[model samples]
Target: MALTLRHGVFMAPFHALEEDPTMCIHRDLELCEWLDRLGFDEAWIGEHHSAGFETIASPELFIAHAAAITQRLRFGTGVVSLPYHNPLMVANRLIQLDHQTRGRVMFGAGPGLLASDAMMLGIDPSTQRDRMLQALDVILRLFRGEVVTETTEWYTLVNARAHLLPYTRPHPEVSVASAVSPSGGRAAGRYDLSMLCVAAADGAAFDALAANWEIACRIAAEHGRSMDPARLRIVAPMHIAETREQARENVRFGFRKYIDYFNNNSPGRFPVPAGTDPVDWFVEKKLGVVGTPDDAIAMIERLQGQQGEFGVFLQQTHDWADWEGTKRSYELYARYVMPHFRGTNAARVASYQWVGENNVEFSGKRQAAVEAMFRKHEAEMARSGGGS
Candidate 1:
């Protein structure tokens, strides 16, 4: 059976240091509007305070702004670093966004991604995961209308309850970020939340994808909660054009700066050996697609073969290409790649085949009808001449 899949961008909006930050943000908003026009299902905006490149400080604020300009594209806080904010505030902010967007919001929780982000807040890196779990528990309880009063080493929640219930039933859809570690899977299972495989492009992460999902399913079973594959999202990087060469050429505009950001600033280092052509290295490693729509389709099929089925495939947004080229890349994906996976063209394909298969018989009948009309005209002319 063909599966219904949703497509979107995971915009940890990577901009070069040379670019103006103000213009970069506006372009990011424009990208969301572009996506909405192209019929994208959603956009997951990142929240980062430190990494300069991934510049959105507040995903919720960005979502509010983006949502107002667009009509139907849903938004997720690619993740709100749960350990960074108070649980009450996190729950309240999302609930308000839920109502504000009329339920076009999703709550994606994670242990903070950047060590520098944690360091700035005086949070111990080692305790971040545990803190995320604890904070999430409180948030979920509050969402359920439970007045939660809990004390923990990091913080204490006293008689806390959300004044406004979520516009979404039960609550806005909740998801947790999963990379190489099992912590995300464990948390997702325990809480029955969706899983966002953020590092699905990494080799180790790709290898562990199925196992982590199994862990989620096993834990869910133990808790009497079943995990839905429809809620599982796998994210990877991609940039496509009319041809593979053109795609590679497009990335040359800003790929080096993106590579620099990852190799130096990000904790999850991208190991591109010196003297290796970054484009060749990236594609050879199967880290992402820097090719045409066919390449993107193949990559998605490869992922499906490895992990079975999933809900969404979020393109890891990058400044690999120039603005126009970048927009074209997404346009190509929307025009060709999406329909291949979505089976959107199935009916049209079937209709064309049906016409082709019956053309001989239909043509013969059409010719016969024309000949009969000609015969009728000649007979009427003869009868009128005889009467005259």
Candidate 2:
């Protein structure tokens, strides 16, 4: 089995749109609908509690809404911070969500980065590793329809049983968010789960992350299990257009707003390490992909070659308020970039080699389109009496 490249949504208010908190939820839903119509495979929302710029603290709640509106797109939490809440409750919610979405749900969990978030919840940042592991174990058990009766230092659940079972057999796919950490990758491999990495500003950073994933996969193999690169997902900011200059302009416009907000509000939150300017970091890291369709395709090819088979490329459109820019980018991507990567059997087969062992599955809409196209061809052939 080979993994195919699957398109996904990274629901976040990354640029100027972060300023208007209200737009965060609305924009994400709007994007979800757009992606659904555009034939994307997955829609992933993130969770961040009390981050000044992010309002998606309750990803499940938002994703539930997205699931309701869309008929086929798979919904995922880009990541839910696992250490901040009770795992039992989270597990129950996931079970409910899986049912609500009729098994089209993926769970991505992580130990959060922000100290402010951890402090607000009385979670010790230092103990996050242990807490995360404990929480993951608990959730996994609960999702498997087992009774979990346990008391951990951070949480207590006495004979907890999920009222609803996940729609996916066993459970929906589980992913771990790994950024600048081997721990997350290793943990994912140990549990036979998927790994999703966010490479902040550098291709090398992405390479490093991929190396860690490979190591994790090897470790899993040693344990009589295997890790599939096709199951690995990456999140990045993407802006595509017909011309490189146009794409650059669109990104620059969005970047200006993002830079202004960070400087004014959380000055040096993403501090330049000694001599590097933030802008340079952004370019070198490949945090934002702004280029012609061909250029964007080349970058994706480089990533696939270096990173191994990736299951999903979750693109975060800078922000929705910049509707024209976002629309242009996505339209170009759909018309030029996406088609190159989708539908064809050769493309699908190549995707597995580039992405990993899992076969890329189409969402219902895409499946229908493909079926209809075949039917049309069949009908035309019949009308011509099977003429060549």
Candidate 3:
């Protein structure tokens, strides 16, 4: 059977550093609630400590808060940088969180993203990969109720065990972050886990996605584990409107923020020669989509064709549009783009056609009843009563 695509938001949530961090967090929670009400399937919160903008330091804490407000939507750590924390603590918190949220939590693991963040934590950036692998090894074992006794340069545990099990059967959905590298794929496959391709919009990763999954399967084969493409989640930033012109115009409001974010913080990632229009350049690179719902649908379809049928399409919700416009864009996606892949509108369309086809029968019976009433009045008039 074909996989029905689910909608979600991959929120690294780049707010300008100048904005109030407190307000930024509030808005993120609001975004979660908004998505929940709009019927989005999941919302993955980003983890960062040193970055001035991507300030949600603990995705687990944020998930707890967001879960309290939202009813049905699931939450992921968006990747808790495995290199930064003790794996046992990470596993324990997530397991307890799974229970707290009534099993709406996911464990997203990754090597720390920022070199500066690693350095600040007294870690060499080069050691992050090894650190992540070791930490994840322990984390997965703990989730499976194993008593781990592992020691590493950064952290150590002696017979550490998780007394509280995850609410999700087996365990919470564990997703590994992937972009242009085979590390994430290999790790996910070796451990039998899900993959979150966070760089689906990036020019580089967009092309490498198939090869990445292929690497995962190869690694899984070596580990005697099976890989499921349906467990993959692709992330792309998009804004939808009724018209392309409106989308282009609306995206301009936060266009500079987008470029400046990459140019300054994510230095050299976006090579816009300091003079040209950043918004035009962004669209020219095809890094993000800003158009009508059809454009959104087409982008998703193309992703599915290129990367295989993924379970989720996560909208990268940078502060590209203002609050109201952001909400409106989500509404457009829910009303139009979502139904296309999910095939939700098929049932509604079928019912409409059924009603149209069956209407003639109803009208014929009603017409006959009216004619019989008229005939009875005509007889009464002939017998001495007059029809009004």
Candidate-wise lDDT, in order: 0.93, 0.75, 0.87
lDDT of 1: 0.93
Per-residue lDDT of model 1, residues 180-235, tens digit only = 88999999999999999998978899999999999999999999999999899999
Model 3 local distance difference test score: 0.87
Ranking by lDDT: 1, 3, 2
TM-score of 3: 0.93
**TM-score of decoy 2:** 0.81
Q: Which stretches of candidate 1 lie over 4 Å from their true place?
A: 266-268, 386-388
Candidate 1: worst 10 consecutive residues by lDDT? 262-271
RMSD of 2: 10.8
Candidate 1 TM-score over all chains jointly: 0.97
Indicate whether candidate 1 or candidate 3 has the larger TM-score: 1
Candidate 3 wrongly placed segments (more than 4 Å): 351-384
261: Cα error in model 1, Å: 0.7
| Candidate 3 residue lDDT tens string, 107-193 | 889998887788788888888888889999998889889998877778879989999878898999999999998899989888898
- TM-score of every candidate relative to the true structure: 0.97, 0.81, 0.93
